[model samples]
Structures are given as C-alpha cells and as structure tokens.
Target: MVDILILLPIISIMIGLYFITLGLWELREGVNRHQYIKYMFTGLFLLFILTPLVWMMVNVLL
Candidate 1:
C-alpha cells in the first residue's frame, strides 16, 4: 500500500508529461483543435492538481 502511494505521483507526472507532449504536437500541426485543448487541460490537471493531491494523501497516510 505504501509503495503504491509513493509511486502514484511519479506515474501521474509521467502521464502528465505524455499528455503535454501530445498536446504540443497537436498544436504544432494545427489540427484537431478541440483534442489539443483537452489534452493540454488534462496534462495540467494531472501535473498541478492530481499530483499534489496524491502527495498530500501519501503524507497523511504515512
């Protein structure tokens, strides 16, 4: 349980980075504007919101 908790943030960070990269690629191509926006939003949310939320949860649990 503790190991998983500790790993969550790292996973989120990687996923967030992947999404942001996709978003940037989409932006560069100037195609599928809605998808690009959604991707960017998801990436920011994961990096800024979810990562800290999980970090706080881990701190509380430990």
Candidate 2:
C-alpha cells in the first residue's frame, strides 16, 4: 500500500505528461483545439491535483 502511494505520483506524472504531449501535438494541428483541451486539463488535473491529493491522503492515513 505504501509502495503504491510512493509510485502513484510518479506513474500519474508520466501518464499525465504523455496526455499533455498528445494534447499539445493536436493543438499544433490547430483543427480542434477545444477538443484537445480536455486532454491537457486531464493531464494537469492528474499531475497537479491528484498527485498531491494522494500524497496528502497517504500522509494523513499513515
């Protein structure tokens, strides 16, 4: 459980970056910027919001 807590953020960051990159690539295409914004927001939410939230939960629970 603790191990998962430690790894969660790292994994989320990697996946989040991947999603953000995909979003950015689509943004460069300039066809459906609004659609890709969802990807970017998802990434940001996972990377920033979820990561710290998990860490805080882990710390409090532990």
Candidate 3:
C-alpha cells in the first residue's frame, strides 16, 4: 500500500508528460494551419495534464 501510494504520483506525472507531448504535437499542426480552436484545445489539454500533479502536491503539502 505504501509503495503504491509513492508510485501513483510518478505514474500520473508520466501520463501527464505524454499528454503534454501529444498536445504540443497537435499545437504544431494547429500553428501551421492557423487553426484557433486547435490552439485552445491544446492549451486545455496541457492544463488538464497538470491536474494530477497539482492534486498530489496539495495532498502532500496539506
């Protein structure tokens, strides 16, 4: 149980990084095509990626 708790945050961070990479890839295409909505969605995707890390931090700190 303790090991799982420690590992959970690491796993979440890895998943978040993956999403960020995906979002950036999409962002590049959006930039090339001058698509506004894609930019917004990509930004949202990046924000969503931050959620897990933020949650972990809050839990640890408080």
Candidate 4:
C-alpha cells in the first residue's frame, strides 16, 4: 500500500512520457500525428490526476 501510494504518480508520469514518445514518433513520420499529440496530453492529464491520489495516501498513511 505504501509503495503503491508512492509510486502510482511516478508510474503515471512514466506512462505519460511513453505516450509523449509515441506522439513524437508520429510527428516524425505519421500521417495522423496530431491525434497522437492528443493522446499524449490525455496521458499527462491522467498523470496530474495521480498526484492527488498520492497526496491523499500520504495524508492517510503516515
């Protein structure tokens, strides 16, 4: 539980980065790169969501 609370947002950030990479890949040669940029932002937004969860966990757990 403690580990998860600590790691979820970190993991989310990494996942977000992965999406960004995908977006960049699309930008380099994809016909529909803008769609991927949208996906990247979605991931980034989701990562933001994870931050509060981690914060709440810290408040509750310790």
Candidate 5:
C-alpha cells in the first residue's frame, strides 16, 4: 500500500496526460464534450487500479 500510495499520483498524472491528449485529438475530430470527459475520467480511474499492479511488478522484477 505504501508503494501504491506514493506511486498513484505519478501514475495518475501520466494517465491524465494521455487522456488530455486523447481528448484533444477527439475534439479535433469533433467528438462530443460528454464523451471527452468520460474518456478522461476513465483514464484516471484506470491509473488508480494500475499503479499498485505496476509497483508490485517492478518490485518483483528488480
């Protein structure tokens, strides 16, 4: 959990950046505003789930 707590924000920011990029692309493609926000939030939620798994994998590998 300590690993998770510490890593979560970094992972979230990286993921958030992805969503922002995707949102921008979609916006250029004329995607709806609602859908844009949805994808961004989904990415954030995924980050929350992925961070702990990533930390565990790194610890195991190294």
Candidate 6:
C-alpha cells in the first residue's frame, strides 16, 4: 500500500506524457487526412496530460 502510494504520482505523470505523445501523433495524422475531429482528440489528450499536474497542484493548495 505504501509503495503504491509512493509511485502513484510518477505513474500518472508517465501515463499523461504517453497520452500527450499519442495526441501529437494523432494531430499529425489528422492533418495528413484533413480531418477536423482529430483536433478535438488532440485537445482532449493535451487536457489529459495536464490532469495530473492540476490534481497535484490542487492537492498541494488544499
């Protein structure tokens, strides 16, 4: 339990980065295909990347 808690933030940050990378990749694919929905996905993934940071900040602030 303690180990899981210690690693949670690190794991989440890594997952967030992964999503950001995927978002960028999808953005490129969208541009190549000239699709608008890809922009939405890109935005979503970017938001996901920020989620962990935001969560950490809020926890710290509170």
Candidate 3 lDDT (Cα, 0 to 1): 0.59
Candidate 1 residue spans exceeding 4 A from truth: none
Residue 45's C-alpha lDDT in candidate 4?
74
Ranking by TM-score: 1, 2, 4, 6, 3, 5
Question: 1-62, model 2: which lDDT tens digit per residue?
Answer: 78987888789889999989989998999899886999899999989999898788878877
TM-score of each: 0.96, 0.83, 0.49, 0.66, 0.48, 0.50
**How many Å off is the CA of 27 in candidate 6?**
0.8
> What's the CA RMSD for each of the models?
0.6, 1.3, 5.2, 2.3, 6.4, 5.2
Please tell me which model should have the higher TM-score, number 3 or number 4.
4
Indicate the worst ten consecutive residues by lDDT in candidate 4: 46-55
Error of 5 at 11 (Å): 0.6
lDDT of 4 at 55: 72
Pick by TM-score: 2 or 6, better one: 2
Model 6 collision count: 0
Candidate 5, position 22, lDDT: 86
Q: Write the per-residue lDDT of candidate 4 for residues 17-61, one digit (tens) a residue.
A: 777777777777778967877977877776677666767777787
Superposed Cα RMSD, model 4: 2.3
**Candidate with the greatest TM-score versus the true structure:** 1
Q: Comparing 1 and 3 by lDDT, which wins?
A: 1
How does each model score on lDDT?
0.96, 0.88, 0.59, 0.75, 0.71, 0.58
Q: Look at candidate 2 and tell me the lDDT of residue 6.
A: 83
lDDT of 6 by residue, 1-62 (tens): 55655566666666656655665676677655434345445545545655566567656655
**Regarding TM-score, does 5 or 6 come out ahead?**
6
